[model samples]
Target: MDFMDFKNKQTTVVVVGAGFAGAAIAFHLTRLGMERVFVLEREEFPGMHASGKNAAMIRQVVPNKLISDLARGGAAFLRNLPLDWPVETKFEQNGSFFLASKKDSEKIQQDGAYAKQCGTLTEWWPIERITEFIPIIEGSPASGGLWCPTDGVIDIHSLMQGYLKSAAMNGAELKFSNAVKNIVVHHGRVCAVQTESEEIPADIVINAAGAWATELGRLAGSLNVPLTPCSRHLFVTKPLDWIKSKWPIVWDITQEIYFRPESGGLLLCPCDEEVQDPNITKNDPLILNMLAEKISHFYPRLSDLPILRSWSGLRTLTPDRQFLVGWDPCVEGFFWLAGLGGHGVTVSYSVGLLAASLIVEGNKSQSTNQFSPSRFR
Candidate 1:
């Protein structure tokens, strides 16, 4: 296949990974009138990894201001999805509470203020208010919490499919179960992508491979942008009368534990992060013990509850915890939309917008400087 064939008609773009990042980028690229977009997913379907396995929470008041800005923008988009959004999704606006002990209370307050300045509605809730909203934290060690009223949970699967569906409706081609084995680069520029069955000629290749991003970059001979896939577990409890569906998500930042109402019960995470291989994640039996310890020390009221089920997912992180969403300086026409860490679901929309702008306008997109792949080099 001649690269000129597709390149002459349309900018042939191949986006690896059909998770939130890839789906959103494809959605926007097509929305912006780009025609030859191909989304290749190794799995039989999209969001088979972290995108589907998350708690589906839309957290906005993160410690990183840059990520917070994207979170705010993404949350706004989720709250008010465009009139033509392809699928129906329910965004549970029960809000979120980022609790902290006295030592970290000031930081939480400051972060909340920054989110507020960025247009997210945030309030500093006292300990009394926190417990009033969720009685389980009554005797907890939390001094106070940052309450972001707009933060909530959404149906992640529906959201992921919505992006793909919209992109497909606009002309992006989605090829599932096609794992890219190698990227064909010539003259320091991406020319084609070799998958399991065939070689696809392309003008641009996007590395949105989530946990496998670093591996994909290596295939393309792009910058070795240190990305690590870390695994974490989420547990769900049996239905309890005390669990309130309207209760906001409560995350103890200092303790690194968070829980929210789910399916007449609660979804909990001990915030365990362990470096792991790209797609191989297993629940360590010891993490459950760790969670038990944290629960006993923190919220005794919710201790020893019957855990119904649990699952693990990967969150790829950069050393600085900021996202990598720009072009590869070492390899031309190879862009990056990876390293979203744990905030992918919360910030995917705005991240896609930024990535599409950079890909289309190149250096003219001044905002790409902060997240440029060259920064790592």
Candidate 2:
């Protein structure tokens, strides 16, 4: 079909999935004057999966340099969103404390150094200083901690909605409960996508399906990128007056556990990373036991607190655990914005921006080379 004919036939840039990555990509595309962008979400609402179910901590002290850069950019985007965007992206700038005992001090220091190199403000604080912020941690075995004042908690639901609303306002279309079944390629180029109900023609196909990204890529007849979905659980406590809402989110790097104030109580996670299917992962009761044990060994005061609620989500991870962005080397017009892991909420904006840039401007941009999907090839 001719370009005009294709345009008339609903030629669109279909973004599979409606989490932070997909929503933000759609938002940026519309902001850049792309009028026929379509977002496909399997859930009834955007971010109902990993995006909304995460801990929502924005930490720039990622393990990799590229992820650190993305976090920095994404954090800046979140901080400045209120100025230009109509939707309110609620973010609590309560900061993050990464604690480490004598065993993991060197690694903590190395992470702090990397964060510093990435222009993230980090301060090495003695374990005693941790008591000033969180008194319950005083008796913990932590020797020192890296204080990242810029790391904060965000309202995941609000942020996801804001991205969707902004994208919709700019003429991007969103179709929830519309799962992509197959990606139809014509002459080595993506031509259309088949959903459960209908086939939609598309000029470009973006795989932002989060944990289901690997499945989407397979539909396009591409190589299997090593993607795994890991289940992580978060638990909340009943309201406790002693737990101040102003307390910064604290992570015990040595133990792989983190806790922060949430709704007059405490939100805690054991930092468990169990590989699982992309479907709804059930909360592991053993995790609760593990969390309680950790709390008893560390913060003894909250060990007996009643658990209010808990939920689990999958963090999609690549073999290298870094984000996969840019276009596929073998499949023309097929793009990837998956992996992300726990960094999705922290780096969604930057990831989406880079993905959209790669689609509109190709690798001519300076930052595009680092995250290009071709890197895996």
Candidate 3:
């Protein structure tokens, strides 16, 4: 197969997911004037898997420096959507509190310092201040907490739709309910992809299949990127009188538990990570016991609340927990945009922008080069 010019507007590019990654990438590619972009989603609707699931929090001051940068950029995009943005979405800038025990206080504070150095405003609030801010957790076990003023929750569904809709408006064809059955690679180069209904020729193929990314890569005979899809459960409580909707997200980094106001009550997670098959998430009752134990030890004040509902979602991860983005070294014109872990909602925009830049310009800067998929090979 002859390699077509990436700059050619006639080049057909197929993205293999309609989740955050694929939607954002298609949006950016179309925005860059790419005319023949096609997005194939297995589900009838977008964000049916990991993109629609999980907590919709925007946590910027994470331990990973590279991911924190992307989170910051993504948060900025959500905070101020473009004037031509096709949809309206809400971003609750209620901020967040990352609680750490005495043993982990130094590391959490150091992470806060690093975030500050990276231009994300952060504050180390003493135990007294934190208790006063949230009276319910007055006797919390955390010695102090890292306060990130910009982190908050977002309307993930709307945000995802905006990206996809904007892309479709710019000549990108989004084909839902179309699963790629075969990625025809002839002589180490991808020529076309056969879907459930028809086959489409492609000059480029992007693997943004979320949890099924590894399976999709196998179909393309691409690199064996160490991607794992881990399932985690989230529980929401029934309405409580004391719960305030404006309260910020509180996370116990040491205990690995987090909670925020939801539906006149609170949403909680135990930060459980269990390896599971792609797109098949089942809630484990044992994890609820673990959540109860963690709540009893870390947040005893609200542990007695009644559980209203629970659901599990997949978070695809690499070995190192950083994002996987770049062209495949094994197959020509095949890109990797998976392995976002659980920060897809917070870092989708920047991740997509970075992937688009690498695909378009084929240049890697010092910062951008860290996420290259070739490193794993």
Candidate 4:
């Protein structure tokens, strides 16, 4: 298609993933008055990947500045959603506790300060204070914990469905089980995409393919965007009578163990990370062993906690561990919204809004610079 023909195409956009990033992008595009957005998912349904397999907690008091800003922004959005949300999403403000050994207490305090600078409330509590809320918590290894009262659990399924529903209500189309093989470019600019069934033409294309983001970038001839999809596991315990229904998420970073009340039991993790290719992942018994080992070292009383179920998912990341959410420097009309690491759920709201703003305004902001795929180049 010529320039004039493409100009007449009503700014059609083909978003190459239908997970949280793609759904949020489509939702924001529609909210920005862009009606010709189309989202394509390779699975029979959206969120079959990382977006669905996450731990469903939002902890904003993180280590990095830009990432903390995104998390804070996303949390604010979730806390005060508009009335038109199709699903009655629940944002449980059970809060989060970031525990640390005395050796790491100073750093935890710094992290809390950083979160406060980002407008998120955080408090550094003494070991006595932490044990007040969590009577079972041990005091020898843990000097104190950072508390963020706004951090909480969310219904991720309802959240994703809300984005999909809002986008659809605003006239965006979602095509499932459609996979893109290649992107056809004309004169160094995007022209169309070759799917399994047909060639779909579009003036703009978004590469929000999550774990397969790097491969998709290669198909679009974007060779410099470095992305790695890594594996992480989460496990849930059988129902326990002593568990409190609303205990805050407990993350002992020093011990690499996190636990939160779930299903009258507890959801826990060993913070296990493994570099792997993007695919359906099966739970590794080694990870289960690792969780058991960590629990024994940290929470000895809970070492024998019966694990009823376990699962794993991919969290794509860049070398710097920040997100990639801007137009590609090499490929015109090709945008990126990947490498979210494990922050996909916490920063979904801000990341989607940033992508939409960059695309709609067609300008560069600080966020565009911070998350640009060109940084990898």
Candidate 5:
């Protein structure tokens, strides 16, 4: 069928992925009184990719100022979820520690100042103070660390479900196993999308497809946005009695490695970033060994801990490492909300609100200009 045939059927806004971005956008749009909104997911359920596989830490101490602002806003929103929300997204106030060496201590301090300027709760802890919270890092780290007290861990599964549930309650439709195959655009504007079984007529198409965003953009014949998928691995050790259940998430900032207490054991990541296609599968043995060796160097006591399991997920990144949020300058009804990288969960709420604001109201905010897709053009 043609655009006009489908256009007369329904005036719907079809979101192409049901992860944090898609679900959150659907929720916000529905709340704003948009009735014909649909969230499409390729998997049988939501958050099957990065959203479900993230480290689940709500960290506010990021390198970029806009990211820090988004993280701050998202963290606050998670802390104060509505009372009637269906799912209970458990927010563990375990805190986060960004350990830095003497060389990078000054930079961390500068970033901490910026974070404070953004109204986030952050403190600089010396080597002595670091041991109070993270006993394992007594003599390992070179200098001090930045302690973000408001930073915490979140149950990502529940958080995604909460967004989807809230969106469904507000009259949004969710279609699972509907992988969008092609986009039907006419007059340089999005009109509909073709899935496996049906043709979905949409007034606007939001590209929240995570790792597959660029491919979707190509399907729509829009601007070719650069999105790279980097694989990050996570390893969890068998439950150990030595580690406390309340241990804060610890990361050696100079070395891109982090570990957090998980069910009496530890969940660790070597922070390995490899450019790869989006596919969910097993963990790489080399990455596991690398993580173990790195843990041995920094955390000798827990290095030999038996690994209970391991898995890998892709973190979609842009060239500057900032999110590409806005509409495609060349395409009329196509919006860009991809390139979240590792901060998807942390900045999801704010990103969704920003996307909805731009789609529904237009770019009227001062901050919105920085994230426009036209920058690449």
Candidate 6:
């Protein structure tokens, strides 16, 4: 079809998924004056999966340099969003504390330095001094801890809705309960996508399906990107008198456990990871066995607290532990914005901005460009 004829027949783009990655991409696209952006969500509402189910942390102390920059950019945006933002999302400015074993102290220090170069404040605290702020914390596995005051918590549901609402205000079409079943590629380019209800033609397709991203790629005849959806559980404790609500989120890198103040109680995680299919997560009560053991070993103070509630969520990750962004090398018009690992909430804004930039300007900087999906291809 000719340009004008094609314009009359289909949308300029179809973004499959309405989680943070998809919603943010669609939001940025509309902000950049791209009209007719279509967002397809499989759930009854946006962010019902990993986007809303995450721990809602905005931490910058990531494992890689590339994602650290994205976290810096995204954290800044979350800290001070423009007044034009569609909704007022709450961002708690409490800092994050990362502990490391004696052997890993130097390495954690190096990561902190890299984060500082990316623009976040990093402070190395001796194990004895880490108690100055968190008086109740006790663990000798870590010699010291790194403190990033800018790392904070956010109301993820509100943030996700804000992006989508802003996009909708700018005329982006959002269709929930519209799961993509098939992708049509003809003459080496995308032509249409079929849902359970209808087949819609599109000029391009973006795979922001979160844990289901690899499945979407397969449907599009794209290469099997190395992405795994792993399950992790979050546990909350009943109210406690000694637990202050203002305590910063604390993570132990060596032990792979974390806890933070939540609702006059505490939120804890053993950092359990189990690879599984991308579907509704089934609660593995057995994982709590490991959680109990970690608490006894690393954080003995709260081993007696009664469990209030628990839920599981999936985080998709690439084997190299970096995100996979940009266009699929083998697919003519397929783009990827998945495998964000644990930094999804922290680097969300930057992820969307970079994805939209790749779609519109067809270019990116080397730092942000390192996450291209072609790396796996």
lDDT of each: 0.90, 0.84, 0.90, 0.86, 0.85, 0.86
TM per candidate: 0.96, 0.93, 0.97, 0.95, 0.95, 0.95
Better of 4 and 5 by TM-score: 4
Give candidate 2's TM-score.
0.93
Candidate 6: worst-modelled 10 consecutive residues by lDDT:
1-10
Writing each residue's lDDT as its tens digit, candidate 1 over 190-299 gives: 99999989999989999999999999999999999999899999999999987889998999999999999999999999999999986565988888898999999998
Candidate 6 lDDT, 1-377, residue by residue in tens = 11212223224889999999999999898888788789999999999888988889898887678888888999999988978898889999799889988877788899999988767899999888987779767754678899999888899988998999999999899999999999999876788999999998888799999999999999999979989999999999999999987889899999999999888898889999999787766789987889999888877866777899999999998999888888777777788999988988888899899888877765333235888876776
lDDT of 2: 0.84
What's the CA RMSD of model 1 in angstroms? Answer: 2.6
Indicate the TM-score of model 1.
0.96
Q: For candidate 5, lDDT tens digit of each residue in 174-247? A: 99999999999988888899999999887788899999999999999988888899999998889988788788
Give per-candidate clash totals: 0, 0, 0, 0, 0, 0
Clash pairs detected, candidate 5: none
Q: For candidate 2, write residues 1-377 as lDDT tens digits.
A: 11112223234799999999999899888877788999998888888889989898998887677888889999998888855576676888888888999988888788889888767889899999788768878678889898989889998888888888889988898999999988999888899999899998988899999989888899998757889999999999999988888888899988788999998998999888898887655878998998888888887866788899999999988877878887777787788988889999988888888877766764455244676666667
The lDDT, on a scale of 0 to 1, for candidate 3 is 0.90
lDDT of 4 at 134: 85
lDDT of 5: 0.85
lDDT of residue 135 for candidate 2: 88
Q: What CA root-mean-square deviation does each model show from the true structure?
A: 2.6, 3.1, 1.7, 2.4, 3.2, 2.8
- Model 5 quality (TM-score): 0.95
Deviation (Å) of 223 in candidate 5: 0.6
